[model samples]
Target: MYNPNELLTRFRKYLQAEQLAKSTVEQYCCMTKYFLNYHKCGADRISTSQIISYLVTISSPVSRKQARAAIAKLYFMLGNHQKMNKVPAHVGFYAG
Candidate 1:
């Protein structure tokens, strides 16, 4: 498994390569790090269900949306298109 710091660095590069706004990149990276720490596992070991569960824990709608987008982007960076597709589309809906 790749080191979490290395993975986060690559993820930052990936977001930059996509030309995302500076704040968006920062927010995504921050949220991704929180998710990684919360799970205490490598990015590859994170399941879609785990992602949803984490998002659900965020009580604020905006924060939950941001977290969902962040995790989706992380999965995209990891080349896990299937898992990316499984992420919830909106903060109001749960991935059931």
Candidate 2:
């Protein structure tokens, strides 16, 4: 029952319902899809550590931060409140 495409559609609707700006909605959706593809697993199965591990691989600070934000929002929309709460708004990208 872990259909990435279906979850993605719901996520898009959630973002629009939340009244996110069009560009923000697009960015979030794109990042969410990328995350889904990268993990290749159900969103419910993605762990907090997995998310952090992915973020660590992004070389650009801006991109890493954006992806983190997107992941957090996506997790929240997916009802993973614990993981969403754990995703810091500003992860120390400088800290290796």
Candidate 3:
């Protein structure tokens, strides 16, 4: 029963605590929020397959890479090491 807004607030604080650049934190939070809203599910319930599915929907390679990184970081902050590990690395090829 995670509240998305609360989760996002904590995530923002976590990113700041990690010393990420301000823009990077903002970008990551925005991407993470988009992912959360897309799934409409609790963060703990998100799976690697869902993450991959969402990543595939992004048309831009750069944006996809950033979203992947953001989602991975979100899972890391949630202490879900397994999900974090399952996030795929960026592929060099983009067909779109």
lDDT of each: 0.65, 0.63, 0.65
**Model 3 steric clash pairs:** none
Q: Which clashing pairs does model 2 show? A: none
Model 2 over residues 1-62: C-alpha lDDT tens digits?
34777777888899899998998787777776666665654343455556655754642343
Model 1, range 1-96, lDDT digits (tens) per residue? 556687789899999999999988987887766666655533434556666567557523436567777787887666666645343332121111
TM-score of 3: 0.66
RMSD of 2: 9.0
Q: Which stretches of candidate 1 lie over 4 Å from their true place?
A: 41-62, 84-96
lDDT ranking, high to low: 3, 1, 2
Q: Supply the global lDDT for candidate 2.
A: 0.63
Per-prediction TM-score to the true structure, in the order listed: 0.66, 0.63, 0.66
Alpha-carbon RMSD, each predicted model: 8.4, 9.0, 9.2
Candidate 3: C-alpha lDDT: 0.65
- Cα deviation at 37, candidate 2, in Å, is 0.7
